[model samples]
Target: MARTHTPRSHLSVLHTSASRFASSPAFYVPQTLSESGDVASWKPISYIQFLHDVELFARHWAHVLKLDGIPRRSVIGMWLSGMTYVDVLHIYGLSRAGYIPQLFSIRLPNPDVVYELLSRANACALLVDPSFEGLLKSCPIPTHRAATTVYDIDSHDMPLPSLPTLRERDTVFIFHTSGSTSGIPKLVPCSSSWLDSAITKSHQIAMPSGRTKRNQDVTVWMGSMCHIAQTFMLLGSLQHGACTVQPSRQAFSSNELSLMIRDCGVNRLNQFATFLAQHLRNSRQNPRLLALLQTLDDALYSGLALPREEEEWAHGNGIRLRNLFGSTECGAMLLSTRGPEMFLQPLDGMSYAFVPVASQSEAGTSQGGHSAPLLELVILAESPDCPDNSLRAADGHFHTGDLFQEIRTGCYLSKGRDDDWIKSENSLRCDTKAIEDNIRATCCDLVAECVVVGNGRPSPALFIETNSDLPQPKLKREVLRRTRQFHSRRYLHERIASADMIVIVEKGSLPRTATKGNVRRRVTEEAFRTVLDKIYGTEWTGTT
Candidate 1:
């Protein structure tokens, strides 16, 4: 297929989803565990009430934005703590009033990064949640205020503020890049039509074959309102009349998660693969939850491919975990595979190819038959939801920043991120995926994550995390065992680097994307700079 700039657009999502599924149930929020630490009963908010909430919020939200000098189509920054039905309402209200909603995760500890996003978006004012009020005060920006929460779902007859007219092509959403690779944040603007398509695409790509039992199945949204993935999942559930399940603000204990699965009958989940791993592990501990998993319709995940072990675990447990590929800039998922298929050869309608980097010399592209040259994965699609202003190559293809090797017709295997490609002074290259894979497999039980760093050095260094309980002696021994195993691979040969340089960090010390669980490579390098300095005898300039 040839690349083309033209894409058919759709109507605004906010005003139409309810009418499209007028008979569907709205959303389901399990009350937070009470003071006594008991799970609360499930409550369902109807579409009627949802619309009323949107209307009420839009009218008043618009007034507040206007008073703060925010005009129609202004980008509004949101510092979100927890995702709720109200946050969903906030997006719709902002869109309805012609204010574009952009989210900055409160999970990120850096106030400077959050402030930079507000500055980049030229946000009129930052609307922060009450829980994030203290965090917002330090973020130097134009101005900030606490946004209204949806305390009551039942609509009151408060004088409705009139909604400003919005356009289908209007930029209604501005989501920041995960920035796990780079600690700094950049914005991805989403138009109303883009979200409109995402709402429908979520169904087409994610819905189980021949099943539309509206309000019967529930979809768990694991991302916060500020994260890009959450908005689509919320709207997608509402469109299908499927109940949207809210994850606990804090990580759910294995027992609590089990109860939610049993009680909520959560058959579908759209979240990072890491969270799913915890659920899968917990299900093994709880028979009822395992039974629930056995009957799951589908599980959609992004962030990174599930560790091969986790993917195998899902299949052995009788679950079909699918992979979703997209970025905030792509608007929504540009490519998705059904079930647990791991290969990413593009299906028809989307054209993908491996190409040499734009700056790579002609010598780099000249390859002998014995070995294949390293190339970047690029995509050319007719997705109208994405604006043309997004990062793109001069040729118009969206360079996904992923690396892959086309093994055969319509099949390709992932090689970590292109930025993770490492080249030593001797020109010997090592794949980050291979290292991470070995480390993960070796420390599968004790390690929560494994990051291979040393893009430009003689050998790679491993930064791993695990539960704080593991004795330092045991942790060191296990990591050393893994390091030995990693180097034992003759395929990597002498390219293998330092194993004794392993750093065992406490949990949560490594920077992670709030929703995606992706390790911020650059951020982690900087965060653990002191440790790396002590080990390497100088500053650690993290690999790109």
Candidate 2:
């Protein structure tokens, strides 16, 4: 029998390959309990079967909603968690049906924000998780019922159908920015072609071989499904015919994660740095992690900043940690495999370029200013024609709001956000990340996480979390000394003199969204109101 291969287009060649794989039993590895005490064993499905299921769900959705011949640009909202295979299938199905899937993160703070984002994005239908249906129903958005229709994916009991042909340039999914601490979540449309390009580029760059072979590697989904980085990793794995091991929605302990790592022989682990840091703290140096690391070929870290200590720890454990720099708007742009060497490399194959801001204009200042310190990303800027104009540039480069500095050869260190940098009394500017890094270097053993916030106030406040056993007075004194040591070299002693350390609640006390550590809201609500007032004997109220 002659094998059929779908033609690649601007939409997505990787998705087509994945669909083809799902049809045959050659790629099928049924779910089985491993000898190791892991919760769920790796279940590999045939690419053909996967495509068939996707087509069935697509047909069912189209028939139920009476949406016939809807154009490729039609938007469908997907409210799902990362744990289910259906989430990935739903995205592929939407692509097959020539519809753009708008994936909503389960970690979004509330339903109102979700509704607002959906309405703003002009979603035509919502494929919701049954568990979250109740919350969606309560959204106050009146026009939601009229403009958008709802489809319960969990409620469906249809059989798998034949797959449909899809174009590569057709948008497969839409990822919204996590508006946890920043502005409202904006839609970032991703074409099937983009996914294919990303996968091809990443594979070429990483050059996996031997046990790092496509089929043998185990990819774990650590971050939220809503995060683009994790989605990209998932798609990349599916394309390479790798086994994916994802944890359940229920609380996952570090011990359980270690078990899963060992049971699955997970070679490739992709996740947020914060999650890995937490895992490193919670899990002891067990045989499982050690065994997994022995066989581990590569690991990728992103989302939050990867601290030096954590990176060093991973390297010490014989794991190659690739620090990746990417955004929801522009897929995966940068991969730092050889640590800082990645920054010195040229912009090759869908990469990022730092555009120095020439001068500060009214419009530029409004949009975080284009100063020497601020590097405007020239790749994947929003279309100027669009009303919202979320994207900054159009010449294939987008102006990333993140601030960075070329510290030395091959190393470009990230400073704090342009908005978060605080100006001291002597007109000296202090980057919060720099301050946080200093604190971490000094109190690495005691502090789990730290966030520096300079609200519209005279001095920046350092919110530190220490070990429960550490005496408050000693910890405060140590923190002050560290802060002084950091500022002394910069000759900003008087400027930072007013800076104060506020001992926030213990680790895990702060609130967090799916992709971001939202310290602003948490500090204001929890630390300022409850703890700081009691400790300092003053009500510290400031807008963050």
Return the top candidate by TM-score: 1
What's the distance in Å from true for residue 110, model 2? 3.4
Per-residue CA lDDT of candidate 2, range 1-544, in tens?
9964443432254446555555433122225444443455555566666655566556555544443334446676777774556665556555555566778766553566677677877776666666676666554322121111123442155443334455544555678654322224566766555555556555543445465434455666655566566666655665555666656432355665665566656666666555555455443466565555546676666654554565566667666667666666665555564543334232255545665556332122211233234455445433211111345445444566655554444345454344554432211234566667777888787677777654322345567667646687777766676666445433221123432445546677665555566555334445455454454343332222
Tell me how candidate 2 scores on lDDT.
Answer: 0.53
- Local accuracy of candidate 1 as per-residue lDDT tens digits, 1-544: 9963332222234346667655555676766675545455467776666776778777766666666676787878776653777777766766666676777666554555667777877777777767766655555545545454576432334456555454556666777654332224456777655555566565555454444353466777656666656655665565555677665643355565556667777777666654556677767777877787776677766655565666777877787677665556653443445544565645333445677655332122111233344567665645443344556677676777766554455555555565664432212234666667766766688888877665433355678788547777777676776566445432221223344567777776778888778887756766776666676663332232
What TM value does model 2 have?
A: 0.62
TM-score of each prediction? 0.68, 0.62
Give stretches of model 2 more than 4 Å off: 1-42, 67-73, 138-171, 180-183, 191-196, 205-215, 249-252, 282-284, 339-347, 357-376, 380-390, 393-397, 407-411, 421-544
User: Looking at model 1, how many pairs of residues clash?
Assistant: 2
Which RMSD values do the candidates have, in order? 12.1, 13.3
